[model samples]
Target chain A: MELLLTNLAHGFGVALSLQNISFALLGALIGTAIGVLPGIGPVATISLLLPITFGLPATTAIIMLAGIFYGAQYGGSTTAILLNLPGEVSSVVTTLEGYKMARNGRAGAALATAAIGSFFAGSVATVLVAASGPLLTQVALSFGPADYFSLMLLGLIIASVLAQGSVIKAIGMVVFGVALGLVGTDVQTGQQRFTFGIPELSDGIGFVPVAMGMFGIAEIILNLERPEARSVLTTKVGSLFLTREEFKRATPAVLRGTLVGSFLGILPGGGASLAAFGSYMMERKISKGRHLFGTGAIEGVAGPEAANNAAAQTSFIPLLTLGIPSNAVMALMVGALIIQGIQPGPRMVEAQPDLFWGLIASMWVGNLMLLVINLPLIGMWVALLKVPYKYLYPSILVFCSIGVYSLNNNVFDVYMTVLFAVFGYMCSKLKLEAAPLLIGFVLGPMMEEHLRRAMLLSRGDWGVFIQRPISATLLGIGAVALLAMALPNLRKGKEKAMAE
Target chain B: MRINHRDVVAGLFLVLLATIGLFLNMDHNLGTARRMGPGYMPWMVFLLQAGLGALVIFVSFGKRGERVEVVKPEGIDIVRIVSVLMFATAAGTLYLTQYGGVRADKVVTFTIMAGAIAAGAIALWIRSPETDGTMAAWTQGEFVAFVAAMVAGVLAWYFIRGAGGYFSQGYNAVGIGMLVGFLVLAIPPGWRYLGLICACMCIFGLFLEKLGFYLALIGTILLACLAERDHIRKPLGVLGLTAFLLVLCWFVFIRELDIRVNLWPT
Candidate 1:
């Protein structure tokens, strides 16, 4: 406990520096800005803003990125309440009760509940992450190459199973993504793999171009295809504060949400994506306001909002400890870290304590900053939403063009972006989820490195994976998971759970 | 016939990619399983991928295909755009052969060149047979705008930053720019707005070095605005947007990030 407090105190010292605070503010602001945009989600927003982080230090960059992530979630829930436009899957649940509350003339109350509940859950989860990060890192330190490979394989399998569409298609995308990642020169032998002798590709495909092209520009293409359909609420936002009775109804739900979110978010495959959905389901079944569901219950908004924020905070444990990205957004984070030349793993905590703790400390600071900035700016954000898609999309295009061009101070990367945009559009039409592909792209090399190292150490013995207890256990769990997902009844349940 | 069209096509695409990967990776040394070569991991991955692709195809037969919907762009002119794209592809091929530093394999390289040329030829005759051949005033206007802008961009880039020798980036920029424009037709006609915006990015990339920041910025914003009919009629708004972007890029790119792209043609 003492160590946790002191470590957190040091983290605060690093995060509270003027430069870091300013970046956090900027990330949150940008996060909210794009989050309020009608159709772009958190992944798209982060990918769009990633270019700006290229110039900052690794810690500051990650601090800002984290701020942007949760800020977008905050922004997404705002739209869920006012416009019934949940920017991502997690916030789709928010729209259910959140939109109803807005129609009940409680827009201000709903917004406040989301913000406060998020702040509370975020505060709790930050402590949980701070307390648990080192312990998990210590546990991860003993993992062998075989164990690491199995764990990553398990992660890939889980990511594919959780994907919304066909499991086989998702697995195919994962394989395809790994193949794409293997392009450029090989690290071990210095032999080129799939560059086709293109000099630019010899260094491997640029991460930013692929990410920006796949998520950002593709989102623009998808958005432009549809006629603009945002219906902004013109009703006055009456009060920012909740009534005592409403607060009383929300307190217990917030507690329950924080508990549900923190626990699930630690699961390797379970990230923030399902936390809001899970909490909403729980609240509907058991909360005091269960009867009020579908009619704008405060519990519906409060529980899910808290759960979502807590889950977002705790999901970093996998990335920080096991070096496994739990979702596409986390995959982008790994890409950013790699670009900065810092390999993410158990070693990160010891080697870069400043980065490690500062990020943890900044999570709380960012949540607080969101609350401070959002309540007063609620009117401004809503008004900003009134900006038409025509103006909005062109500006994003120019940004993407310039941002990509600035990467190498040339146009080659921009060309890559164009290619990926077309490919991304095609993928959506084919109903393939890009998330698994992205996760695979980021983790593929690491998995291969571990696999090769383990094989070399074990003298080509494939049984080494099963021989190691941790590796065997993880692979066993993965096999069970794959089998369970194949079950007819379970597959039906999975489709329903992931349908949103 | 009852199989899911999306799954079959997606599966076939994956298979094609995996086969290509297998073929390309076949030459690399595949060492013993204990000490793997650079090709070993990729080779295994491709095999797994191809198997998965086959499985995807096989599974599709069990499910009914959903009718895929394609939305038409409300009133966008596509003929002038295709003509310009064809002209640029032919011209870009000439420039690439003359200057590109392509150390890529001859067979693969020439195949791409030939493909681009053939695609350009087909695009040259892309007008729908049902439509009358008489050109609209707007088509003529769009044709002039696109050709003039591209010409100015190429000339400006050539005179200014085109000093770099054999491996000039003009080749790569134009090559990738053609990729989206030519292949976009594979999707339904109504979905060509995607191609247009992609072309805008290509224009920006292709010209940023040659035309410099301000001119490149102006060309891209103007071209991008053409895609949305709502913004095209309002020239003042377009101009305002151009100006806004100019200053925004100046402040953000030049002042803030300190990226060294020039402001004007040297």
Candidate 2:
């Protein structure tokens, strides 16, 4: 405990540095701006900014990226309250009570509750991370190659099942992403697998192009296909501070949300949206004002907002400690770390204590910065909504083109981006989700490496995975998850067959 | 017969890709599964993709499957697609001839291939009758004539450069041809501005290093501004906004950060 406290203090020393603070503030500002905009999310925003962070120190870069994430979470609720439009998926629940509160002339109160609840959750989750990150690392350090392989398999399966689509299609996309990840020169044999004679293909498709193309460019295309819808804001934004009674009602809800969020956030495939939904359900079940659940209830606004923020922070635990990303945003972070020449895993804590701890400490600072930045800036954010998307889209396109070009100063990457943009559009049209593909792509190579290493160690004995207790348990969990995903589909298939 | 068209198309595309990948992997050594080679994983992936494709196709044949209606493009869409393709080909040719160190003969070969493909595409477009009422016969005739002239000019430039031993000068001829082509092609009413903006972006990328940042950006903004339906009426406003954005980009990306890019053509 003393060592942990010492490390955290040292982290604060690094995070509070002028340079780190500036990056954090910048991230928060950018994150809030994007979060306020409908259809733009943190995943795309982080991927877009990934190239820019290549020059910064890893610790500063991650601190800023993390800031952007949680800052966007806070910003998402603002839009939810003001526009009745959820900017990010996690804020969908907030829209229920938040928009109602805004309609009831309690926009300021709702915004304040969201901001305060997020700050509280962010602070508590940061502590949870600091406490559990080291412990998780210790457990992860004991895992062998087979254990890692099984764990990754489990993560991928869980991600596929939890994705918002047909389980079969999601699994297919994951496999497809894994294939895409296998494009470069094979590490073991030094023979290119699918380069098709392009020299760039020998190095594999870049993460930035694929990500920017799919999430950024494709989203722009999708948005442009339809005419813009005017956003309606409530006329009166009364009283930024909550009433004494409202505060009393919100405090317990926020605490419950933070606990629920922190716990769920550590589980694989459990992201901000799930946390927000879970907390809302829990809040509704226990709240004395359950009858007013959907109608301007402070508990509804506080719980989900706190839960999502806490989940957003604690989701970092898996990525930081085990090097296994639980969701797409964390997967992007893993990409950022790899670009910085730091392989994220158990050794990260012991090898780069400063980065690990500094990032955590920066989260608390960033949350504080959000509270300071968002409340006064609420008017400015609302004003920004008045800017027509037509004018904004061209600028976004130019930025994306420039950002992608700056990666390697090669036009081939730009062409690849165009290809992926088309592919991304096709995915959307076909109702396929991109998140599972992204996580699969990130984990594919690592999974292959571990699988190969385990095979070598066990002399190609397939039974080796079952012989090890931890590996066996992980594989068993994966099997159960696979069965769970398959059972419902199988039942549906049988029902259809019988009907026919 | 009543299968979901979207799933069928997607499945076929995946199957084709996997088959090609499988064929490509056949030449590489496939070591045992324990000690895998370069081809091992790709082979497995191709097989998996093929299986998934088959499964998707199978599911599409189910009774409750949703059939997708593929919307056919109108005359303006064809024009936009062809013009964009032309711009990309010319730009790619110029970049390769100038910086990629391609031989003059290879440039000529590529230009011929691109011209042939464009000709085929134009033929296909002509075969497809216009569905929109706005596409008058005269307009179609004018569009076809403009496209043919543009293609001829580009091909003539390639021949002149190839035969006249002035490979570098071919770029100027093609650029002129494209500019004239764009000016001559009367845009149909109610066309989406995104198409024109996309074309402008292609041109901007092509000329980014050659025309310099300021000139390329100014030209792109000018062309992109024309994409708006009201650009003719509100010319000055669009111009001013373009100038402002140019300066902003210059200050942020170049001046403040000192990015190592050429501000002016060398």
List the pairs of residues colliding in candidate 1: B157-B210
Alpha-carbon runs more than 4 Å astray in model 2: A228-235, A489-500, B1-5, B63-200, B220-233
lDDT string, candidate 2, B42-103, tens digits: 78877987887777767777764333332243344665566647654764566466545644
Ten-residue region with minimum lDDT total, candidate 1 chain A: A228-237
Fraction of true contacts reproduced, model 2? 0.28
Query: Fraction of true contacts kept, per model?
Result: 0.78, 0.28
Q: For each predicted model, how many residue pairs clash, with residues at least 3 apart or on different chains?
A: 1, 0
Tens digits of per-residue lDDT, candidate 1, A1-500, equal: 99988999999999999999999999999899889888778998888888888999999999999999988888899888888888888888888898888888898999999999999999999999999999999999999999999998898898898877778888899998888888888889999877866788998888888888988898887777666455656656668789999999999999999999998888776777678889988999999989999999999999999999999999999999989998888898999899888999999999999999999999999999999989989989888778778888888898888888777776778878988987787677667788899999998899889989999999999999999999999999989988987777787776777664
Quote each prediction's TM-score.
Answer: 0.88, 0.83
Candidate 2: tens digits of C-alpha lDDT, residues A147-236: 999888888888876776456667778877788888888888788766755688898888888888888877776666545443656456
Give each model's whole-structure lDDT: 0.80, 0.75
- For candidate 2, give the DockQ: 0.23
lDDT of 2 at A178: 81
- Where does candidate 1 chain B have its weakest 10-residue lDDT segment? B128-137
Considering summed lDDT, which 10 consecutive residues are worst modelled in model 2 chain A?
A491-500
CAPRI-style quality class for the chain A–B interface of candidate 1: acceptable
Badly placed stretches (over 4 Å) of model 1 are B63-189
